[model samples]
Target chain A: MDLLYQIFVDPFVQMGTAPDLLVQTLWEGLVSGVLYALIALGFVLIFKASGVFNFAQGIMVVFAALTLVGLYEKGVPAFLALALTIVVMLGLAVLVERLMLRPLVNQPDIVLFMATFGLTYVLIGLGEIIFGGDPKVMIADQLYLPRGAIDVNMLGGFVSLQKIDIAAAIIASLMVAGLAVVFQKTRIGRALRAVADSHKAALSVGISLEQIWVVVWFAAGIVALATGIMWGARSNVSFALEIVSLKALPVLILGGLTSIPGAIVGGIIIGVGEKLGEFYWGPLLGSGIESWLAYVIALIFLLFRPQGLFGERIIERI
Target chain B: MRMKQLALGVALAGIMAAPALAQNSIFVPLLTYRTGPFSNSGIPIANGMHDYLAMLNERDGGIGGVKLAIEECETGYKNEKGVECYEALKSKKPVVVNPYSTGITLALIPKASVDHIPILSMAYGLSASAQGQDFPWIFNPPATYWDGLSMIIKYIADKEGGLANLKGKTIGYIYFDGGYGLEPIPLLDQLAKDYGFTVKKYPVPPADMQNQSGLWLNVRRDRPAWMIMWGWGAMNPTAVQEAAKINYPMDHMIGVWWSGSEDDARPAGAGGKGYLSLNFNSVGANYPAIQDIQKYVIDKGNSQTAKDKVGDNFYNRGVMNSVIIAEAIRNAQQLTGKKEVNAEDLRRGFETLKITPERWKELGLEGFAGPVNVTCTDHNGHHAAYVQQWDGTKWVKVSDWITPMKDKVQPLLDAAAQDYVTKNQPWPKRTEACDKSS
Candidate 1:
């Protein structure tokens, strides 16, 4: 009976986060949610295009950011290094088209995903060779990111929000909107969507699958680069960046792989939900529940919804 | 047939070469976490180890002109991989093992006792390793979690003017949910029982601590007078930010040595100003050893850290770990007469080490931790620590070196170590190795 009290009843009784503290806690969750969503955006972009989960997306972020920083450190100007990183990502896209995608065309999705696992290792080794293994503080000051926070009055309380976080949220929303416009309105976007819908049908329609693969991958690479720079500014850029990227798995589950809107909404929900959960309920369990909270939430969502909030309902032909 | 003949021939040649090759240099097995979540900190440490060996070779022509050989196997913080690395390297007759992870060190404790290989778990590993009589082969120089926790509690007590003032005051503890974070719990509990403070604990889960509302909300709700944190890696930054969010005064927060780093501070730069953490070694753009590191390690392009990131707290600790290993080997050479000594020789070296203030100054570590004097009964050679506050941009020393309640801590170390032995059913044989005197 005492054990039961310790396990369940005692936890809630101890809850006493003040109103101001509650608002601030929610703000942290919202900020972290944005970052998690940014990482998941890259995975969703690739998964939607190729039907192959890009395991190397996380490393790509680290690798791209590291390359940019390393080149800048080598006396190359920041803007120039950023340009060169784009080129590197493009070169990588071309290399993937020629070496991986083209060669393994028509392969099973599992095979393609496994090949990405191989790619992750290759990038890790290559990145380490090109840029030595070490964590680097992002050039936030150089990148001109706003530092410090603004205290806002709310619910007879106050909440502090970093200016850079606001900028990130704005930029991420724009980028997603831009991608949606490109996919819906632009010729290349339609071709890519066609390829996503039916690779055989897209080929029959005379769309050069090779061109679409290169273009979509290069676009994903750009997303990865942006995600890297933003997250790297939060902490030092290092191989550890890869671990942070793994948080996207729960985000992807919450947001369906096939639905872009799902990724956006799901990422925010997981991010905000985990924070709120940690703030409100973490004390009951002795804290540290935020890590697994997203997966637990996603699992529960799966049980009820089956399809994600915005995802298409499956109609099995069988 | 040809493959078999060639393999047999190669095996025979290797066996023949083994006896012909003289073992003049000591082999130190490095169990490094150079590719894990901790690698942000570990890579620099491994680089420090390598550069110091290079420095020895460059400056002294190698431990009395016999040279030092170091072979590192990357563990990435996996205990099983660390054990595999230890097994793979032990056959090479290593002088000692310096495993960077607490998990790995715990795994190696039994292996070290059985294999006769001494381990140097500096400022890490099991908190009870300070009880050298029980832990025959383990050396935790410059205190343990118990020592660090006492120092913080002592400082807090001193600030409050008396132990009695702690009554009804809640003390918050946010620690990682692992053995490394758990080490200070027993000591904290004892102090709370004695001091009449209500203890509130919040455990940070690993790799998933970015959103830490659960922990920080608890601190705000409890309204603790002070918070002591024992966290590492992502846990540090997240905890700091969460604390800042809940408007917890960063100045009243205390972190253990492992949790305090430039990387850890930068994320919470907004709310982290004046956050105090214990420092066994001071770090910054200053420090003479950092000059040696920049000149020898980074300049040579052999540094494991970015050239700009040198002199950061964890990077300096990496350099210090290498210094400890090198100094031990140098001390071993004095007693053993052999230029290259084995694990037993290094054990004696660690036991008899007398790194005075002058030696530290000469080694370009004038202000790092004043001095470390090793003894058989006390494996933690140095018991002194000072407080450093992250002043938004850098770590600045805020207090003189203060020794914790050693009289109170020693008995706890002894008792816990005895419990470890009894639970593990280790033999009651006395570790007479301390008396061998080479």
Candidate 2:
């Protein structure tokens, strides 16, 4: 009975007594959720278009950030460096399409996925060679992102919110809204949807599968650059950031691999759930639960809805 | 066929060239990681180690007229690859092997005995390996993790008036959830019991190193009077940032030596001011040995180190490590009367090594490190360390060298060493005489 109360009653009572702390924890969860959502958005874009799970998406985040920082270190203006990074990413998309995707066209999906794994190693080596494998301070101030924190007095206590996190949340929302417009209203959007439906059918209807692949990859690279900036602002920019990409997997699974809105919702659920578990109930289990709680939540969800919350339902006929 | 004859001839030439290569120098394999998540810290240290040896070669024509052949095998900080590097290089008959990571040190400890190579782990490895009676092949001189933790507690006690003032306070320990990070736990727990304090532990998983908001929030809620961290790599910067965000007193928060690099505090910018960490090495390039390295290696563009990273903490620590190894080699040569000493002679050199104040002055390393005298029974030497604080720009020594609580730490070391020996049954007994001259 004592153990049960500690498990169920104590956490809620603590939360009630310290509402300010509760608010602070929730805010942190939401900010982390936005970052996870951005990374998942990148994965969803490429997967929807090519039916390939690009394992290189995480390294692409590191590569994009490294390129920006490396160029700036060489005395390039910040805005010009940002522009050049985007061009480099676009060139990378073209090169990847030409060198890897073009040769392996019409191959099995697993083979294409394996090709992305090869791309991951190549990018890791290239990034290290160019950037010299040291952690660099993010050029947040130069980029004009907000610094410091704001403390709000509410619930008879103070809750602190980092201004950079608020900025990241706002930027992530705008990007999602802009992506939604692009997907819904553009001519290229229609072609992308047609190709996503059936590559051969889209080709037969004169959709140009190759062109759509490049566009989708470029879109994913842009999302990666945005994520790299926000995350680097939160911490330092290093290859260490590559490990955090693993956190996006549960977000992708929960949000459904094919849905943009699902990625955002899924990210928030995992992030908030993970933080809450680590804070309130973690002491009961000796702490360190944040590392695996997101996956556990996704695994439980998988039992009931393997198609995920926003994934398209699959039908099979015998 | 003619192709087979050509292949045979090439193989024969390689075999014939092997002895010539061996006769030219002594091999010292460095298991280093220059590209990985840990590379931010690893690169500087590896460069320091490499440049020091290069300096020795350029200035002194190597130790005793034979050039020191330093071969680097990249492990990327992974234990499996570290073992693979060890296996690949053991055949070269290296005089000593420096396994940089604690994980790799733990993996190589048992194998070093069979391979007859002395494993020099510097200040980080299994603390119990200091009990040279049981583990003769592994050496971690200058200090051990237990020594580091005891010193931290002593410093806190000194600041709080006395050990008695620590009775009712809550002390938080934030550590990485790994063998290396958990090394000081037993000593901390034992000290807490003896002093009547409450101990709170917060573990940062390897995957969660960069994402530590939850852990910091708990620290705020617990309201510990002080916090000590056993973190490395990306975890260091993140922990400092989160602590600063929560308005934790930077001076009251301390970290182990691994967490004290410039890479750790520089990311936090101005918010990282007054952060303190323990140090077993000097921090600047003012020493004569360092100046020689700069003149001989860096200025000549013979070093892989960046010019700006010359006086950094981890880089200087790496140079200190090489200083220890080079001294051990010189000691072995003087004792054996042979320029090329084998692994057995190097082990004797480590057991009887002495780096006194006079020797430091001679080596042009005055004020760089405390004197380290490794005895037959005490491999760690129990050398003292000082506290250094980050004063916004760089680390400055804030306290004199404080000795560890040896009376309290020795019994724990003995028990842990005995536990290890019992677990790994049929462990070799130390049959060699301690008083024998090489």
Candidate 3:
């Protein structure tokens, strides 16, 4: 009874007394949640159109950012280099469509999914060879990211929120809202949803499967580029940033692959939950809970709602 | 096809001008990581390696009039790939290799001896390789793992008056769960037992660092006087911030050299004020070699980092690494004529290297490193380090240089290394090269 009081109830009692720590924890969760959603948006864009989970999306984030910085360093202007990077991403999309998707168009979902694992390696090798294996500073000054922090004094304690983190949360939310509109209101978006429902059925009804995939992949690349630049600025741009993409995995499992709103909510829940767990209960288990807490959260959620927050019930047919 | 042709052309060119290009040339195998969780650290180190070599060629027309050849193979921090790199480069007749990882060094020990490749692990590898007879081809200049751990205790001991003062005090050890991390556990445990200090262990999962409340809560409850971290990658800054959240004394907490680089600084920059660390070499803004690197290399736009990052911790460490390797090769050329040097020649060269204070001033690496003596039975060229504290913006040197407790470290190293041999059972074939004079 004493141990339970110490482990489970003590942290909340402290939080209740010091409401400021609770508020600060929430803010940290929101900041991290925004980043998670940003990564999930890339997954959502591709999955919405092609029903394919891009296992290479994480590498794509590193690849796009590396290419842009690498080209600019070689004397190309920043904006022009960004344009060139867009062209490269488009070229990559076309190559994927031709070499991978087109050949496996009639293949099962598992086959297409397996193909992405191979594509991840190809992007990694090509990125390293062309850019030289080095991390680069992101375009923080040129891109005009906010600098410094906003100190807030609340409930007898003070906490700081970086201006850049605030800017990121706003931009990420706006982008997600814009994406939601595009999916719900645009004709191309409707065609994408149609194709995602059944590829053969959409093809038979005169939808151009080829064009929709290109557009969806291009959008996914753009999302990756944006995440890369932001995360790179927050930290240094390195191949290590490749693992940040995995942070989105639990977000996917919790939010459901199909629901956009679910991604946002799930991201925030995981983010806040992990932070709170790390702050409160982590020491009891020996700390370092932030790493695995989200996966465990998603696992427990799966036990109850296997279809996820907004995913349709998975049906089996003989 | 193109690379094969290029390799052949380079090799043929070497043979054709064999005498002229002989012992003067320094060949270095750079086992690098371009991909993986640690790439952020690896890439900059590679850039520093390449940039320093370039500067040597440009500033001095190469060491002793022979250019340096730094061949890099992307290992991504994997032991198997590192072994493959060693196998591929063994026949290059090179003198030394900088493997850049502790696990990789452990794997390369047998091969380094078998293939006659001298390894310069700097401060990032197997601590026992510091024992020269058992590890003739391995060299770890500056501090080793035990050195880093002992210094942290030494700092604490001084504050409390003596080592015996630590009795009943709790000390925390939070680390990534791996060999590179667990390398210091036995030493720490022994130290705790010797001093009667209580020890707490917190094991972090790989590639992620979100929750540390469990460990911090214990710290709050137990109130350990100091926390010593042995971690890598994102774990460093993350651990620092987690400690901060729990209000652990940032000044009292110390990270090992690997965990104390600038890459670990920026994330918790402001939040981790007064965080202290043990650094093997003095690699920061104040080093003279850094001014040269900035003016000659970075200012000339040959840097792998932003121009301003020239004097950062990892970058200066890079410069220091280049300085040691370059000097070793320079020393090797004396016994082996500049035209006929090989692995054995380089080993002899390293054995005689003595980088004095005067030499450091000349090389412009003055204040960043200490005097180094490399000999047949002492593969670790030096074993001195200083404490530095982050005053928010940059790392400021706090203490004069400190050496590990030799009585404490030597026995632990010998015992552990001997165990490694006994566990492996079959001894590796000798890595010694036949000396013409002998």
Candidate 4:
């Protein structure tokens, strides 16, 4: 009864008493959710177009960030380096599509996934060799991202929100909206959907599968670059950032694997839920519950809706 | 018949020539991680470790006239990989093995005596390994984790006026949830009990290191008067960033030695200003030994180290590690009168190791590090460490060298060591005789 009281009643009481901390925790969760959504969006783009779960998406974020920072460190201007990084990502999309996807086209989906695992290692090795292993400071100042925090006095206390986190949330939202516009309205979007539905059928209808793959991958690369900048600004850009990408798996499970809006909603839910769980209930469990809480939430979601909150439903006539 | 004879003869010749080739240089295998998550910290240290030995070979023709064959096997900071590297390299007859990771050092401790090679963990590994009577082949000179923890407490006590003033105060500990981070907890808990303070624990799992917003949010809620971090690699900078975000007092927050690096602090930028961490080795390229390393190693295009990172914290740490190894080799050479001393000879050197202030100057390392002494029953000398504060750019030493409370620490260390031996029943007894040279 005491344990139950501590679990169910005490947390709510604490929440009521310390509303400022609750807001801070929620804000942190929202920021984390935005980042998770950005990474999941990259996964969504590739899976939607190619039907391949791109394992390389995580390393791609690190690689893209490293390229931008590496170029800037080599004396290239920040904006120019950002442009070159985008170009590099485009070139990478072409290279990956040509070398990895084209040959493995019409092959088993697992084969494509395994090929992405290989790409992850290749990017990790290449990033280490080119940038050297030291963690590079992201050029947040040069990129005109805000520094410091905005302390708002409310709830009888102050809630400090980092300016960079605020900027990141705005930027992530804008990119997601832009991706939504492209997917819903553009001709390329129709081609990608056609390929995602049925590759052979799309080919029969005169859609170039190769072209769609590159375009979708390039789109995913753009998402990854945006994610790398925001996450890198939050921490330092290093190979370690790839591990945090695993957080997106739960997000993908919560938000449908192929749905854009689902990604955003899923990210926010998992993020906020985990933060709240960790903050309120973590002490009872001796802390460190934040690591596994997202997966637990995802597991509950899986039990109810394996297709996720917004995923397409399938029905068999047989 | 001719083909068979020639193949057999070549094989015989190769077998005969192998030992001869090994005899010309001293083999030292560095279990390093230049890739993976910890590479940012590992790379600089790897370079420093490699560069110093490479410098010795280039400048002094190696310790005692034998060129040191320094080789690095990448562990990527994984325990299994570290053990694998150890197994693969142990056959090379390496005079000493420096398993940089605490987990790896723990894995290698039992193998050390059996293999007849000294394991120099260098201020890390099992804190109980300081009891050299039990862990004769394992040397973690300078200080142990328990020592460092006590010193941190002592430093805190000094700042707060007295030990009595710490009563009713709460101290938060955020640590990497591993053997390395967990090593100091028993001592810390004891210290908390003795000092009348509450200990709030935050264990950062390896996976959750980068995402520590939840951890810091808890900190903000708990409102601990002081925060102590035992973080490493990416966790260090992220913790610093999160702490700064929650408006935690930067000066009140302190990290262990591994958590304090340019890589750790620079990412946090101006927000990490006034953050404190402990250090045994002095920072900067001002030391003559460091200049020699730059002159013979980095300047020669031989070292993989960047031009700017010659005197960075982790790099200097690696250099100091090699300095101890080199000193051990020299001492072994003098005692055994062998140019290329074997592993057993090196073990003797480690057991009888002593470096005074005069010796520090002689080695071109004046004021670069505190003096280290490893005795027959005490491997780690439990030296004093000073506090260094990050000024947003570089570390500035802000305090005198503060020694650990050895009277309080030694009892705990002995009990822990005894507990380890009792648990591992078939633990080998120390049969190696003490050297008369000591």
Instruction: Tell me how each candidate scores on DockQ against the true complex.
Output: 0.40, 0.82, 0.31, 0.84
TM-scores vs. true structure, each candidate: 0.90, 0.98, 0.80, 0.98
For model 1, residues B362-417, the per-residue Cα lDDT tens digits are 88777666688777777786478888899998888888787878877877888998
Residue-by-residue lDDT tens digits, candidate 2, A76-189:
998899999999999999998999998999899999999999999999999988888888888898889998999999998899999999999999989988888888899998
When candidate 4 is compared with the true two-chain complex, its DockQ is: 0.84
Q: What is the DockQ of candidate 3?
A: 0.31
lDDT of 1: 0.78
In model 2, the runs with Cα more than 4 Å from the true position are: B1-16, B435-438
Candidate 1 per-residue C-alpha lDDT over A167-254 given as tens digits, one digit per residue, 9 for 90 to 100 = 7777777788888899899998898889888888999999998888788778888888887887766656777778778888888888
Task: Give the per-residue lDDT digits (tens) of candidate 3, residues A157-244.
Answer: 7655767668878888888888778888999878888987888888999999988888888878877887787776665566767777
CAPRI-wise, candidate 3 is acceptable
Give Cα distance to truth, residue B259, candidate 2, Å: 0.7
- lDDT of candidates 1 onward, in order: 0.78, 0.90, 0.77, 0.92
Which of candidates 1 and 3 is the stronger one according to DockQ? 1
Of the candidates shown, which would achieve the greatest DockQ relative to the real structure?
Answer: 4
Highest lDDT, which number?
Answer: 4
Error of 1 at B126 (Å): 0.2
* Of candidates 3 and 1, the better by TM-score: 1
Instruction: Give the Å error, residue B406, model 1.
Output: 2.5
Pairs with steric clashes in candidate 4: none
**Given candidate 1, what's the lDDT at residue B342?**
76
